[model samples]
Every structure is written in structure tokens, then in C-alpha cells.
Target: MTNIYNEINALEGAFRKTAEFETLKEAVEVVKADEEALNVFKNFRKIQIELQKKQLAGEDLLEDELVYAQKAAQLAQQNEKISAMLEAEMKVSKVIEEVNRILLKPIQTLYEDIQ
Candidate 1:
């Protein structure tokens, strides 16, 4: 029988070697080296986390908070390093999502025949 844990560990190693992961690493380094870009990225991430927390708590977002989040996103996008990092993050997330779908296929198939 195959060792699932060992297979997962090997998949983790392979994931780190992917081009999407490499691009994300480079983009993050570029953002870190630029003080202004790093600040913008941090602020945007902070806002994102705060908004997500509010959502998880079932609270409605205030208009001003939404506006501020939108403005922060714009600022982050205007920073070249941050924009590149965000793009790289999206690419990496897409790859992870595909991997998750593939991993879930067996479970999905098992449920498909249930009455």
C-alpha cells in the first residue's frame, strides 16, 4: 500500500519547485526590498484580513471601510513591486486550487453514486 503521508510530502516538495512558486518568491523579494512597496502591500493585506474577519463574524461592512479597502487596493496595484507580487500570488493560488481539485476527486467520485 502507498504511504499517503509520504506522497503528500513529496507533492509539497514538487510544489515548491514549480514556476508559479518561483515567480511568487521573486515577486515577494522585490516587494520586500522596496520600502514604499512593502508598506503598501502590508496595508492592503491588513485591510483584507480585517474585512475577512468581519465577514466571518457575520457583520456587514461599513461603506467607509469598503471605500478604504478599495483605495488601499488601488495604491497597492499602483506600486509595481506590489502589483507583480499580487499577480504572482494569483498564479500560485490558481495552481494550488487545481491541485486541491485533483486531490478531492476520489472523495467526490465516492459521493456521486449516493442516493
Candidate 2:
């Protein structure tokens, strides 16, 4: 049988070696150096987590919450450091999401076959 743990470890190593990871690290450092940007980024993440929880629980998301997030995003975009950080974060997130989808393909195929 294939060693899934080893495969996952290999994936982790590959991820660490990617340019996206380096860019993300640099972006993080830039954000860390800027107090205002850091605060805005932190607040944005807090709001995002709250919204995500509500969405996950099947609760109705209010328009005000969306507007709040939008405003936070706008503010982040106005600051170059925060904007770069957000972009880097999005790139990293996309990479992880794609990797996860690829990893789950086997299970998805199995379910499809069973049904």
C-alpha cells in the first residue's frame, strides 16, 4: 500500500520550497513591520472568521457584516503593505485549496464509484 503519511510529508516539503511560500513570507514580514497595516489585517481576519462561522452554521449572514468586511478590505487595499500581504495570503490559500482538492480526488472518485 502507498504510504500516505510519507506522501503528505513530501507535499509539505514541496510547498515549502515554492516561490509562493517565499513571497508569502516576505509579505508577512512587510505587514509585521507596519503597525497600522497589521492592525487592519488583524481586524480583517477577525471579521472574516466571524463571518465564516456564521456561514458554516447555516445562519443568515447580514448585509451589515458584508459591508463591514468590504470596508475592511477597502482599507487594506489602500495600504500597499496590507494589499501585498492580502495578495500573498490569497495566493497561498489558492495553492493550498488546489492541493487539498487534488488530495481528495481519490476519495471523491471512490464515492462516485460506490454510488
- After superposition on all CA atoms, what RMSD does each candidate show versus the true structure? 1.1, 2.6
For 1-115, candidate 1 gives per-residue lDDT tens digits of 9999999999999999999999999999999999989888889999999999999999999999999999999999988888898899999999999999999999999999897
Instruction: Report the C-alpha lDDT of model 2 over 1-115, residue by residue, as the tens digit.
Output: 9998998899899998888998999999999988988999899889989999999999998999999999987887999998887788899999999998988998898899674
**lDDT (Cα, 0-100) at 77 in candidate 1:** 93
lDDT score at residue 91, model 1, on the 0-100 scale: 99
What is the clash count for each candidate, in the order shown?
A: 0, 0
Give candidate 2's whole-model lDDT: 0.90
Considering every candidate listed, which one attains the maximal lDDT? 1
Best by TM-score: 1
Estimate every model's Cα lDDT from 0 to 1: 0.95, 0.90
lDDT of model number 1: 0.95
lDDT of 2 at 92: 92
